[model samples]
Target chain A: MRIEIPGEEYMVSGHLACPGCGAALSMRFALKALGGKIIVVLPACCWSIIAGPFPYSSLKVPIVHVAFETGGATGAGVKAALEMQGDTETTVVVWAGDGGTFDIGLQSLSGAAERNDDFIYVCYDNEAYMNTGMQRSSATPYLSWTTTTPANQPKENPKKDIMEIMAAHRIPYAATATIAYPEDFIRKLQQANSTRGFKFIHVLSPCPPGWRIDPELSIKISRLAVQSKIFPLYEVEGGEKYTMNFEPKGILVDEYIRLQGRFSHLSEGEIELIQENVDKEWNRLRKKAGG
Target chain B: MKKVLTGNQAVAHGVLLSRAEVISAYPITPQTTIVENLAELCADGILEAKFLRVESEHSALASIIGASMVGARTFTATSSQGLALMHEMLHWAAGSRLPIVMANVNRALGAPWNIWNDQTDSLSQRDTGWIQLYCENNQEVLDTVIQAYMIAEEVYIPVMVVLDAFFLSHTSEPVEIPEGGEVDKFLPKYHARYKCDVNDPHSFNLMVSPEYYQEFRYKIQYAMEEAKKVAKRVDDLFAKSFGRGYGPIEGHLCDDAEVILVTTGTVTSTSRGTIARMRERGVKVGLLKIKMFRPFPREEVKEALRGAQKVAVIDRNISFGCGGIFGHEIKATLCDEEKRPQVFDFVTGLGGRDVTPSLITEIIEYTCQNERPEGEIIWAGMRG
Candidate 1:
């Protein structure tokens, strides 16, 4: 397969992101797809640090760093203001962490989406709060070992069904993408950019330090997540119409889990429990997709 | 032609005349009527602007921020918890310097969830870098909204035009709704010097390290200081054309009074009424209305209070653990003065509790009779 690199590079090379950071790659691919006519609204997260310091920005596009819990609202505001100026050609994309999107920013995000605010909201899921040091977030998977949730007591809550919550808004577009699928990810971005009203793209980005995974295996782990049916790639149009983009091989969830240290402490029973949950979720998604 | 209009309707008319391209808002009590009127205007084609029906107050502010960054003259109105929800983006709007104007109908914050008049909501955001302008009446509310955009765009700072909750927001008074052309002459199109331009790309509100963070903050402070002059110029230009004027601080009988009451927003009107009644009875009292709260008008405040024997600050908002919101600011401004007036702090009218002219009279009479307490905040109207 011929892999085509993006012709335009909106993201600069000297970003302060960690080596092989999946969230950084997600940003690169997103900016590449959206092009220079983009305004990135970022909330407090790893990306906040990754964007580099002021007067020394890493992206060629304009970035508006908002508060941790205001990504959706800020993006909506930016988009509204832009349209007011008769500049509807530019795309407003909100890039937020799982903590920002799923937890603190959920109310605002839900509000914007429900209003069908003309903008793109991308929740880069790193699972935990990597910016303020890895604390447990709502997006943190059950049985995950975040600093706040030690092995003795892993995350008590299951990973929030963010895509479902977004879908509930009956938004024009909502999709799941991953760093390992650049083509698919870019395609979704282009689709979202063209669509009117609220469009959401949930990117399952891997965090090397927070996830306690080998930096080199970031992409590999992300791929395994889909292959294992742990994080399926799918899209919903107008919220109700669901379309699964990729079919997982239904590999053992342990294969995806073994790559990360955070899940290493899990016992066989716990791993099996997670596998059951993944399978159950995939089945439900398949049913929704009319497969 | 002067017409009696509610403060909310006056603000709506100001936004309409200012030619705001977008108005996004959620319905919060005391502030709901402003956005509701705006929505009606859009529906009636009285204003050619997008009236976004945002689901929450957070989204309302956010939508305006987005609109303003792309070079739109954007506006929104909210109060209380709504303002708190937009607390995070308040920094974003100012840091991005979008010059988005907001009308914050001041209300009490929640735990008990009471929705009434108080300065706590807006005053709590004093550090968010927004240029705050408090209005004393419907006329000021109407005029200040027009001037806020001018001052905000000039200094590249987001401006918050605050009105007393039920006092100004709901109360009806005669306000001159400036003509569109007149407003156009006074307020220029919002042409942002630095904005999110795609063709000529540049990063905005980017992360800053210690080396550049201080400079960024310093520049914001410099812009705020510059806003003081811009505010004065805008007010002057406004008066020249409309034949009325206001300042960062409005002095009422302060020229030769022995005691001056320092207040803000609609309370200033009641204070003036109280001062007038007192003067008839041979009490030498005056009023100092603080219109601008962010740049604080520290030098102007000190100069205004310099002649008074005692200055009693009446605050409607509490800092909780600290005393009154305005009292602290007043003391901070007078801290370095060698011969300062005896500063008496009085906290009253929180959560939209009424502060009639008689209340002001009592506070002043008490201050004159007793030794002015230093560093102590006296609750004037709280009943057990």
Candidate 2:
């Protein structure tokens, strides 16, 4: 298939992001899709380091490194201000980490979405707070190991249902994407770009250090997540309409869990329990998508 | 045309005349009226702007940031807790240098949940890289909003026009709303030199390593210092166009006064009134009204109080362990001077408590009679 992607490139090659950083790749693809006419609102996150320093930015587009939880609010303001100047063509994207999106930034994001603020809010979900050294976040999955949630007693709470929370706002568009699936991710971006009102794209990013996975297996793990129905690829329009983008192969959830060191300590029973949970979630999502 | 309007309405009219393209705000007491009026204007097509009704203060700031990124002239308003909620984005707006204008109705920060006048909320955000302007009355509120955009865009920094809650925000006074065409002539449409343009896309507000972060901070600081001159120039031009003038600090009867009262926001109005009353009673007292709080007119403040015998600072806000919020700032500004006035700090009118003229007279009288006390914060008007 000959796919004609975006002609302009906003991100440069010499970035300081860690190799196999899913968030960085997400930004790279986002810049490609949004083209040069973009303003990236970045809160405090790993991308902050990835964008390099002032006078030497990694992305070609203008970046606004804001506070940890101001991504959504700041983006809405920028968009409004741009429209005032009779320049509505430029796209304003709030690129935030899972911590910023799910926890500290939840209120702002909720406000923006509720108001139907015209902008793209992209949450690069690495599952934990990597910038501050692998601390626990609301996005952190259940039974995950981090500096805060040690191996002995992993994360007690389940990962927040961010997609559902965003979808609840009845936003114009809300979707889940991954770096492993570039074409699907890019396609979703195009769809969001075309739609008006609030658009949310939650990308499940794999962390090399935080996830304790082989640096090269980031894409493989991300793919496995979709295949095993652990992190299903789906979209919701107007909060009610749900559509599953790709059908899972119905593989055992262990296929996705065993590779990551953070989840290595899970026993057979625990794995079975996780598999049951995945199946139940898949059923619920399929039902929502009308099978 | 001159119209009798509350300080909130005057600010709203200033925003309307400024031709602001977008407004994103969440309702907070005192500041709610400003946005409510703006929303009404947008609805009535009097002000052609997009009014974004956000769910929270954070979203209000974020939405405006996005709007500003696209190069729109944006505005928003908040007070106390709402301002605190926008604390994180305040840093972002400044760091991004979006030149977004905000109206802050000064209120006390809560533990006891007070909604009265104080400078703690805005003053706490002193380091957020925004040009903070404190207005004493409705006229200043109206004029400052128009000039804030000019000064902010000139220096490429966000500006916050602060007014005391109830005193200025809810109080009514006559204000001259400048003609839109005249305002346009004075303050042209904001053309960001470094905005997010599709034609020339360049990364802004990116993360920087330690190697270059200092440079970014220095640039912000340099821009702020430059803003002081830009603020002066804009105020000068505004005066020339509107037939009125203002500065970082306004001195009232301070030339030959033995006691000077340093204050900000609407309290300055009461202080002026008290100065007149005291002057009638043979008291050599004057008033120093501080307009700009961020690029804190330190040199100007020192020069203004140079010949004064004693400087009594009456702050409407408390700094917890410290005496008065503004008092601490004033003392800090004059700390290294060769000869400083005997500074007395008095905390009063917290949580919207009244700052009547009689209280001001009594404070001045006490400061002139008693010796300066160390770390003493006399609670003005607190009856046992």
Candidate 3:
């Protein structure tokens, strides 16, 4: 069965993304939704490589490859210049990896959000710093096995709540998305492109190499994440009002964890702990959305 | 329009006349006044540009690059620690060949946190690929900013018009702020050949393999070398229109002198006064004010100081583990000379302790007497 997606594809073939890379699919879906009139600000990320080297770009849109920590600020700058030039049409999208968004780029991201600069900032979270050989970043999930976070000592803390951080800035729109649901991802991107102020979308992209999952299981594992309530799909309009995009089926978190080798060492007791934590977080999101 | 303005005000006025489309900066000592005045210019509708008040110096430079990528003429200002903070982005701006002109008020870097006039800060970024143009006074500070845009755009290299922290940035002086029409003739509107455009999408400064990386670096090197000629051509055109032009190297009374003192920034004026006093006492003394530091003015520096029997450098900053940065470059430039003059360095008045005319005269006298530096550097004005 073929799904009817947007006909216009902005991403070209022969790019440098890994096989079944969720970030690559996310970029494809994002560019399809945003269309041709756009500038993609890519920080130092997998997309930096995925966009190909100089004189070679897989992206059909203009790409401004900036410093890792300067994505938000650079997008704001491009938007400001466009506005000054009487160009209010072209949209500026800052597509950064999780490390750039949650850790190194947080200050500039926060500053841009606080100023309400007009641009769409999307964080394609692949759990860890995959570009630098899967180093553990602030966005790395709990008990995930990164190179730095070995099996003996995995990440101890939960992933940073970046959407809530953006919400605290009272931006016009903030949403969580995933490539498993193309409509949800495209809708959030379109919504962000429509609004005037700062719009942030946190896309939970999966990584086959970094997550230690089979190449074909990238989309399946991504779907399991949302289905198991580990990664919820939601939106916060006007920063204060939260709207749940989809309710999870309340499946066992074990299915999602067992799919990736990163969580292969997790005992049954640890799996129960993760379920309790996910349940508490889901309930909190529900309460915030007035469910 | 001749106006009595400080160096900071002059830079703002220059930026205004150049029609900068995007201005981004963070407030630092000495550099603060430049951006503050630019903000007022933006607010009063005098300058039509997008003013971005960034959180840090790093973002300020990044924002300027971002704006420049979209074919927007951009400008920014910073000093000392601020310039140091924008170190990484500085390389990006130059390597990308963005042609973003910036005014860097030169101040000493901090350990004890002193915000004073020193050349160390700007000189520290010598390897960052920015064309460094040190200003001698308010007029040069103003005119250099205008000239910088023209030079940067032509050579595709970013320019940093540097001035002494407070000596030039804060002190008011008579400077001819060129009219819009005059500046229009000097510097036309910036139209980027390859910028971020929706119609023609491309990536800028992306990762390059080892095979292609050397070529890109060589291109930057070619641009820098080409800038020396471009700087001269632009200044000549500027002189043709404005009746005043400072070249890459300026020689004052060096035609028939035995000892010449090399200086940069605001101290050039003091060197002039010291030379005049020495001339009154029948001493054969001359002055060489270096305006351009990046291309190092190598051949021109050698030619200017070649006539003298002895040459002395008054460096306000030291390059730790070595002598003055300028002294090292000067020696390296003149090393292949068979008839090169005896050279020495006088390290003095650091942290804005005031490099007076009397101090300069003493250095001149010392240069006239010594064949070469006895030790490494002559610590002038120090208690030791």
Candidate 4:
């Protein structure tokens, strides 16, 4: 078996992404897979600023910068317009952040999935609203310390199961991939590229700024998430069948949390409680995957 | 061909004739039938286009903006609340300079949730940079939508063709829909100076610094000013082909009159009968119909009301504690004139209340008789 990366690059250097910005790397990998025949519909997110200001862009492909909640809807429109022009080669990729996908953009995303509008919806989850200075999002994990969820009272609710929600739409394809696993990310994108109907890819993007981690640990944090089974990598097809992509080593969740300052405020009791919840979720996922 | 149609159906017919490549809409009262009929047109192959039944008005407008960015003619329709929901994207469409055409059925905004006709919904968005056109009847509704695309594309700005709720949207009237080929001959396929092209790539509507942002705002304002001329030119071309021309502002019997009643939307239709009745009594009064509300038509309005002693503006919408919206604009437009007419703001038929012929007649008499309105806003036909 061989691991290969696509030679072509759509995301060039000189972009404003910080050190170990997983979302930036995720886009770089996405563009490599999607190639030149794509248009990115971006809602307000980190990339809205990261892609540079007016009259300048980091990516080679065209970007349609829309409001925060309009990613899926805008992508559908762009795809339809291209179809009407008798040019269906270009793929409309809705690139959005966690807050956009899990909260404001949910209706639009669900609608697009229901219609099975021909486009790829990529929701890169950096855990919270990183662009707005580390506010909490529905996608923010339980016991995390975003600005909104301060150190005193960390995020109370568990991270939303967007994969399950999207799978319920019974879309053709729904997959999870992270930048730490480029081969996995690229493969999933290529799968989405080949699929005919609506496809969703959830990328577990790591943010150094909002996560209060050393910029060097962004990718390391992502690798530990999979290793600890806190953020599992998997795919769902037709909103029914679930396939686990990687098997975590059953490592302690503390190995992942200790590297990031967001979880530093948690006591021993809270850490154990989080570990128990992760075990329960892992057991349920394993059951579904026939482990 | 003469077909009796509701204002919504007229919009659908116009969209079909104009060959709008994409129609994205969500159903809201009064605006529902337009997209419903459009869906049928799409299904029957009468119109070769994609009809996107969106989840919400936000998505509806967002989708249209996307389609328009791809150099395809796009359209959508909604009313009051739905229009309000799409308010944020309205700026996006205008700022991106995408020439998308939309039909807005004028429904009242709600705290009590009213679905009737009122201009407040569209009037509230006057500063959004959309070229707003108020329709007088079903015929005008059908004609203006086609002209909206022409003007919108020419100036690279979005156009909103607005009509009153049930009075126009639900009321059936005879409309002469032009043939598709003839409309195509007049309004050709959209050719974009800039768009989302794959082979030829460029970023559209991205982040702007304070330094260059003002220049973009200036360009949109300049385009809006140009839209005034483009609207008239496209309307003239529409007339040359179809024999129906709707100027930005049309002054009726204003050649010599003491009082002029200014109206917009379907209320202008209701005002006509009152004007005729007043004329039989030998009262020298006239009607000034504002078809184009944006670019305000300052010159035409100034020229039309120059000699009139009293100019009464019958607004179906108010600016909340400030009097009527049109009243404010007309007053500001006439403030510097050497001999400006005393502009009185009279609000009538709000929240779909009936603006009857008798009411209009009484309003005309009141404006003619009083030197100044006793109050800033005269609420017509209110029992309380």
Candidate 5:
């Protein structure tokens, strides 16, 4: 399989990202796909630090680190300004974490999507608020143990289906990708860049410390998440057409969860419940994709 | 061309003449017509700008912050609760040094949800480092909105052009709409010193450690001080292009007055009428209208009030535990003066109640009869 990734390096080596950070890899692939003629609007997220501090930056492209909930609005603004300045070629992309995307930033994101504003919104989902420490966000999966949701009182609710939310807006493009699948991630970003209106790409990034996983296992865990059907890799066009990007390996949910310490306290019954939930969701997604 | 325009319509024309590249806003009372007019202007192909109709006030300000960073002349307007909602982004806009101009029509903050005129909304944003300009009429509203872009762009600070909700925003007056060519000559297209450029890629509003954060803040304050001079320069240049000028503070017969009345927004207009009537009756009263609030016009305020035996501050807004908002600022301004007037803080006409000429007469009479101010807040026209 000749999975060709761009050789051009837009991201530098001296970023402040943790070892094997999935978000860092996702940004690298995104920047590579989108190239240099782009400005990234970052809301409060792990990427805020990962993008490096003032007087220093990791990416070659310009970045504007805005307020937490302003990802969507800020992206739209950047696009509007670019259009006003007669520089419509420059793509405006918003890179945010799960907390900014699914929780705090959802309103702005929904707004931009509704307007079909010209920008690409990328949600680097590490599940919880990884920057402030492992706290539960709406994107946190069922029974996941965050710092707020301790082992005894784990997350009870299922993760919010953000893809559905994005699809509901009937935006021009919406997709799910992960760092493990570099080709798919880059392809979706390039496609999003080519399309005119508001585009959303949800990347299932893995947090090493927050997810209680070894630094080296981030990619492995991300791949397992796709194969185990816990996080499906797919795309939606104009909120209706759904396309499954990858064929899941049909790995068991326990195999995916066992490696992470966040799920260490889960009983067999809880694991079964999670498997059942994942199966149901996978079936629903397959149906949407017309099997 | 002399045309009768509401304060909101004046704002739309000012923005149009200034050639603002981007306008973003959320609908709130008294401020809605400003954006509605702009929307019509944009849709009719009269104004070459992007009108981003955002979902909330937070997004309205946030979008402009982004637009300003991208080197576009941006504007937004909101009132009361909307301004409160945009508090966080207001700091962001100023800290980033994006010269985004905003019109805040002063409406009362509410738990009972009353939407009428007051100074509390923009006053609450006083600490946010935005250069605030209060307008007394529709002409000043138009003029200030045009000058704000020049002042803000020059100092690299955001400016809030404030006006009374019903008094100025809704009230129509014959405003001299400056020719677009004249405005273009006064204020040129915004040339940002620093902006988001992919070719010369850099990061903005990034995480600054304690080592450099204070210096960044110092720069903002330093620019604020510079804004005072820039504001004056812009006003002079504006007067050159168009035949009108409004400095940070406008004094009416204050030099020889025994008692002075300090006011802001439309209250200044009402006070002007009151001053003329009192002067006719041989009562030595003056009017000092404070146009610029954020940079406070401290020195100008002190200089104007220095000769008066007593200065009565009629405030339409209170600061919760602290007396009147402007009253506290005036006292603080005069605190270090070697010889200052007996400053009386009078709170009146809160939540859209009229500040009539009779009310002004009672305030002045009370101040003249008393030797000293009894308390922090003397509620004027309180039904005992």
Candidate 6:
């Protein structure tokens, strides 16, 4: 079987994204699948800087950089205005970071989801607040070393299950994709594009400097996250029917943890604990998928 | 057609007539009826607009900002706490230079948690780059909302049409609701000069270095200066269509008066009656109702109070530590004037305390009896 990716590129170069920035790559793929008929509602994220400064934009699409916690509401508004204009062809996509989706912007996002407002919300999860110099966010994994959560006292809480929260809203579409799988990423984005109301796509975006990984190893680490079953490639339809898009090799969590300095302080025992947690989550997801 | 409408319902009718393309709002007391009326209008097909019942006031304004960015005429309404919650978005809306109009029903902020009328809610937002026009009655509330869209769209600055809670928001008054065709002729459909478009794509509100950041703010200030003229011109145009006009400030019997009471919102109505009775009783008292507070009709204020020896600024809202918010602005406006009147700040009717005719008379008497203001703020009708 053959998989196809669109040749047309909506994102342009000269953006200020760091080397191997997964979030930036995610946007490139997103715009590729979404085509030119979209307006991006960007909140306070790394993309805010990566989209280039004033008088210079890195995308061929129009961008409305809104307040930090207003990603969902702003997108809803754009879609509403477009609906009023009788232009239903344009898709209003909210390109937000994990901090916006999981933390400060949660209420607005939830509000939009609850109302089943017609828009696509994409959260590029880099695990931490990478734009703000690698602070600990609710999306930051347990035992990860961030600027706020130092090595001695790493992040005590586990990464929030954002998918479950979004699924509870019973939105039309919700999916998880990573940059390592461009075909899957593009396919999911296209699927979200076609869906009518309140679609959410979660991309496990990697950060090089913030994740304490070699810039070149960003995509490799993203692949390992999926292979280890730590970050599953999946989709939820109407908050129920779950389909695992990519069946992982189900490797141990050590390979995913060892590539980055964020988890360097973790002992063998802690790695085992993380493995147990990942396995538990994988099992729960498998049961939901009726595997 | 003349209809007896509350200030809130008048706002809905104004928005309906103005042909606002999108309406996004969250319900808050005193402001709820405005949105409720709008919802019904949209449902009944009387207003062909999309009404977004957002979760919070922050989203309420944020959504409208997005709508306005995409070249849609948008509006929202909220009271004190809801307005306070929307403080961040208020700055965002103005900074983005989206000409969105919002009706703010004046309600007191909480600590002890009061939900009644006061000016502090909108007054505190003076520097948010929004043109604030306070209304003295329901008629002005409806008129100002329509004029706000014209003025804001002209200058590309957000405008806040503010009215007192309960007094104007709930009280019914006969308002001349203009026909849709006449309003359409007066305030035409909003066509954004710059907007988010697919054909001509651009990023807005991006990170700007110091080299160009100051210029953006300079333009906003420059636009504010332009808004003062636009506001007056829009009012003139509105009167040409609707047969009634409200200037930035209105002065009654100020030419030969010894004492002038400066007021805003519904209190101005009471002050008007008090000034007439005082004039009949052989006391030289005048009434100056400030309709626009933001691009604060400074020249009009100075001209009206030039002959008056004593000016009492009646504030239904306190600025805390400073004096009345309007009182401070009035004092600053007259600071450079050669024959400026002695401005006395009298704070009363806070937290919805009644600003009765007797209260107005007492405020005037206090201004007359005193040689100068004994203090920065004289607490009127306050228990010892």
Among these predictions, the greatest DockQ belongs to 5
Tell me the deviation in Å of residue B342 in model 4: 0.6
Better of 2 and 3 by DockQ: 3
After TM-score superposition, the amount by which residue A290's alpha carbon in candidate 5 deviates from its true location, in angstroms, is 1.2
Best by lDDT: 5
Give the per-residue lDDT of model 5 (tens digit) for B24-48. 9999998999999999999999999
Residues A62-94, candidate 6: write the lDDT tens digits.
999999999999998999999999998999999
lDDT of 1 by residue, B244-300 (tens): 899999888998999999999888888877898899999989889999999889989
lDDT (Cα atoms) of all candidates against the true structure:
0.87, 0.86, 0.90, 0.91, 0.93, 0.92
C-alpha RMSD over true interface residues, model 6: 0.6
Local error of candidate 5 at residue A106 (angstroms):
0.3
- Pitting candidate 1 against candidate 2, the one with the higher TM-score is 1
State the DockQ, from 0 to 1, for candidate 4: 0.87
Clashing pairs in 1: A54-B207, A77-B62, A77-B63, A77-B66, A77-B67, A78-B66, A80-B67, A81-B66, A81-B67, A81-B68
Looking at model 4, residue B341 earns an lDDT score of 88
**Candidate 3 error regions (>4 Å):** A1-4
Worst 10-residue stretch by lDDT in candidate 6 chain A? Answer: A1-10
lDDT at A261, model 4 = 83
- DockQ of the candidate models in sequence: 0.64, 0.62, 0.80, 0.87, 0.89, 0.89
Model 2 chain A: worst 10 consecutive residues (lDDT sum)? A1-10
Residue pair clashes in candidate 3: none
Q: Return the TM-score for chain B, candidate 3.
A: 0.99
Return the TM-score for each candidate structure. Answer: 0.94, 0.93, 0.98, 0.99, 0.99, 0.99
Q: Each candidate's root-mean-square deviation in Å?
A: 2.4, 2.6, 1.5, 1.0, 1.0, 0.9
Give the residue spans of candidate 4 off by over 4 A: none
State interface RMSD in Å for all models: 1.8, 2.4, 0.9, 0.7, 0.7, 0.6
Locate the minimum summed-lDDT window of 10 residues in model 6 chain B: B269-278
lDDT order of candidates, top first: 5, 6, 4, 3, 1, 2
